[model samples]
Target: MPPSVRRSVEQRADSVGFIAVKRAANAIAEAARDSNSVRLSGAEHTAAYLLTRMPATYAASCKVLDELRGVPVASVLDIGAGGGSAALAAHEKFPLAREITLVERDPLLAEAAREWLPAAHILAGDLRRMTTFPPHDLVIAAWSLGDLPAATVARLWEAARVALVVIEPGTLRGAAFVRKVREELLAAGAHMAAPCPAAMPCPMVEPDWCYFAARVELSSMQRRIQGGDLSYQDERFSYVALVRDPVGLPRARILRRPRHHPGLIELDVCTAQGRRSERATKRRDRDAFRAARHAEWGGAV
Candidate 1:
């Protein structure tokens, strides 16, 4: 996480000083074990969530925003904005955005959002009941779609006037949800914007899923609460960017980290045609090999 964001989270955690960090950590662990349980009810658990999960979520959201490099975003609506991490990320990415709205159901989480995101328009309502949403240039649902029904997801996509970005955990199940949502958005006439070369159809199948990882440095308080020896963590996430207007597409997206050898580079790429493994040897293709050498996991080749 960036120093600014880390400081913001730390300040919020400090405000909720009555709760013990250990209890909040334990609550977060218990909630993680059971997906169907209601977790963000009290201030302590909300604070714990800010301390433990907010940084990684913010990092992943920022990664998604980075994909929209040249696109203009003047307004943003973040659905299921727990702790307002997505809103914060959007503000950092597009500082010119005149309006940012955050919709969350839990009262405690909503309260925390008010403290963290004073500039955003916080709408306290259940997503299932939200029949109509306000218009915005960008609509984001980060780590929020898995809990929603397919109909609701489609509705949210329909509300996007410019673009829609959905993010989920990098687990297999999360990838499945992202794939399903991608299909729904495509059916709704949205165009692929990132991490995909085309909008034809997902070429991936079972035992293989599309995902990316973002690295976040853990705060001292976070390390103490989670009892971790490492000073940083990698947050794996699956995301898709859909736009109303057509944009330039990459020829192929590197799905995995490039493999380097003595004089060769291997890249696992997904293109509009299909998934394939391509090799670039220094002797055969000097330029291609140089490009592959610097390519990261999610970059276009």
Candidate 2:
């Protein structure tokens, strides 16, 4: 998370007491474990999300949007913009973006987003009921499409002039939603942009799902509220990026972190053909070995 955003979150946490935030955090976590969307109604729940959830979500958004660095993005629209995490990440990634709009169903969250992003147009409306959205170069539905109807979700793609990104939890249910969106959009003429090497059926099967993790450094207040000993957490997320134009697609995408040992490197990557494992050794392929040794999860290989 950016420094400016971090400070803003911390300030919000301080306003809410630790006990109330902790209780709300536990409730929110339980809701997620049950694969249920939480409707945060109180200040405690809102603050809990701002402290315990927003940072990790922002980190994941940053990682996902970084892949689209070369894509031209003049404007961004964030659906289900909880505390504006995705919008903040987009603003940081695409500095050239002139217009940034965020749609949040929760009025508190929308007001909180305005505090962080004063120049942005934060709209308070339920995305499910909205029939149409203004077109933008980039449309983001991060952690917001889970409960949306298929038809409503389709409208998000329609609003994207250049690209659309949908993100969900790393759970099996979340991956299922992402897969459904990927298939539907691809059939509608959208092309795979990131994390997918080709516009083909997902190679992952029932037991395995496509997901990535982003390490987020927690603030002191965040650690206290969550009751964790560690200073960081890995935010796991599943996402699909679709673009109107297919350009600069990679030959393969690393699905997991590379394993290195005894001068050998192993990469589990998704290729155009299917999911496969690649092995590289110093003696056999020095260049490939070097690249694999430094490769990260969710990177192009």
Candidate 3:
């Protein structure tokens, strides 16, 4: 999270107190384990999310949006925008974005988003009932759409003038949701923009799923709220980006963190043809070995 956003979140969280935020954070975590939708029914819940979850989500959003560096994103619409984390990340990625909009069901969260992004248009309503949405260059649903039906994804795709990105938890269920959306959009003529090297059916089998981890810096307040001593946390997430038109996609995407061995690095990647293992050995290819040594999970190879 940026310093400005971090300060703002701290200011809000300070008012709720540590004990209140801690309790709310635990409740929120428990609820998330059981349901797909976020439950922000009170101020404490909202404050807890801002302090504990927003930073990780923002970090993940930044990482995911980085893949769209070359894409022209003049406008962005964040559905189910909780505290405007994804929207804030979008603004950072596309500073020239002319228009920004956010849809949130929880009034408290909607107001919080408005406070965070004063220039954005905030819609305080349920996304499930919304019949239509304004078209935008990029439409993102971060940690959203897991519970929504396939028709919701179609609606979101229709509103996406350039691309549609859906992010979810890294659990098996989350991977299933992402795969479902990917197959649906690909069948509708959409092309891959990130993560997937090809549009072919996901070669990943049932036991092994596709997911990535984003490391996030934890604020002091967040550390207390989470009751953790670590200064950083790894947030696992699964996402798919579908563009309206064909784009230059990567030849292969590293599926997991590279494994370092004696003078060699092992990479599990998804290629245009299928999934396979590629090796980079210092004795064979110094350049590739150097790149693989610095390679991160979910990066292009």
**lDDT per model, in order?**
0.85, 0.89, 0.90
Q: What is the lDDT of residue 298 in candidate 1?
A: 81
Ranking by lDDT: 3, 2, 1
Q: Candidate 2: misplaced stretches above 4 Å?
A: none
Model 3, stretches more than 4 Å misplaced? none
Worst 10 residues of 2 by lDDT: 219-228
Residue 28 lDDT (model 1): 77
- Mind giving the per-residue lDDT tens digits that candidate 3 earns over 162-234? 9999999998999999999999899998999988998988999989899999999888877776675899999
TM-score of each: 0.93, 0.97, 0.98
Backbone clash pairs in model 3 (N, Cα, C under 3 Å; residues 3+ apart or in different chains), count: 0
Judge candidate 3 at residue 38 and give its lDDT: 65
The residue-level lDDT of candidate 2 at 118 comes to: 92
lDDT string for model 2 (279-300, tens) is 9999999998888878999999
Model 2, residue 43: C-alpha shift (Å)? 1.3
Q: In angstroms, how far off is 286's CA in candidate 3?
A: 1.5
